[model samples]
Target: MNYKPTLIFGRISIAISLLLIVSLLFIDCNSDRLADIKETEEILRKADASIQNSITQKNIDSLMSFYAEDACLLPTAEPKVEGKAAIKREWQHIFEIPDFNNKSTLTKIEISKDGSMAYTMGTYLATMQGEDGSPVEEPGKWVTVWEKQSDGHWLIVVDTYNTDIPPPDHK
Candidate 1:
C-alpha cells in the first residue's frame, strides 16, 4: 500500500504546519508591541498638550509637575540646571520677566521600542518685556526627554531649548 511514502508525506505536512504556527505567533507578538507603541505615543501627545496648557495658564506648579524630581533643564545661554528645585527656580526667573508669555507646539513625540522612554520635539514662541519695556519675541525649538514612571506616567527627564535669533555680535 506504499505506507512508507504516506508516512513521509504526513511528517512533511506536520513540519510545515508547525513552521506556519511559529511564524504567526511571532507576527502577532510584534503587532501587539506596535499597538502598544502607538498607544504610548498618544499618551505623550496628551501630556504635551496638558503641559502647554499649564504654560498658557501661567500655572508654575502645574508646569513643574510634568518634570521628574531629578530632572534637568538646559536653558538657553546658561549652564545646565539639575533637580526639581533648580528647575523650579529657573522657571520662576523666567516667569518674573514682565509680560512674560509662552506658547509651545509639539512637532514630534517618539517612543522607545521598549515603551519605557520617549522624546518630544517642539517649537515655542515666547514674549517678554525687553530692557526698553517693550514686548520682545523669542522664537525657539525645544527637545524634551521623558521617562515612564512606575505609575505609568511620563515625566520630563531633560528639557532644553534655544532661540532662533542669533547673538547681537553675530548679527
Candidate 2:
C-alpha cells in the first residue's frame, strides 16, 4: 500500500544520481593534463621570461605571442582591455609613453593541485616621464592567469595590475 511513495522516491534519487554522474563525465578532472608538474612549471617560467624580455625590449610582436587570442588585460583606472588586438593596442600605447620603462619580478608561480590551472604573482616597477617632464616611478603588483592549449603550449589568459600610488584624479 505504501510502496508507491517509496518507489517514486527511489526513482527520483536515481535520476539525480545519474545526472550528477553525467556531469562528472563532462567535467575536466585534468587527470591527464599537466601530470608532470615540475616540467610544466619550468616551461611556464621560461615562457614568462620570454614575455619579460619582450617587455624590456619593447617588442610588441614578441610580447603578444604569449597571450591567448581571448586574453584580457585588467588595467588600473581604465576599462578592461579585451582580446588580442585591443590588448596589442594598449601595450603599444604604453610602450610609446615618454621614457617608458618597466621591469616585473615574478614572486610566485602557483599551479593547481589538480593541474587544471596556473597563475603568477609579481611586482613591477614602471617608470615614465610625467606631463611636467619629471620622472615618475610606480611600483606595483600584478597577477597573471595562464591556460594550457591543445597544442601543448601555455598562454596568458588574464593579466591584472595596479600601482601603489594614488590615482591621477585623486592626486
Q: Model-by-model lDDT, in order? A: 0.92, 0.89
> Which portions of model 2 show Cα errors greater than 4 Å?
1-35, 168-171
User: Which digits, one per residue and each the tens of the lDDT, describe model 1 over residues 36-99?
Assistant: 9888889888988898888777788999999999999999999999999999899888888889
Any idea how many clashes model 2 has?
0
Please, what's the RMSD in Å of model 1? Answer: 1.8
- Please report, as a residue range, the 10-residue window in candidate 1 with the lowest summed lDDT: 162-171
- Each candidate's TM vs. the true structure? 0.92, 0.76
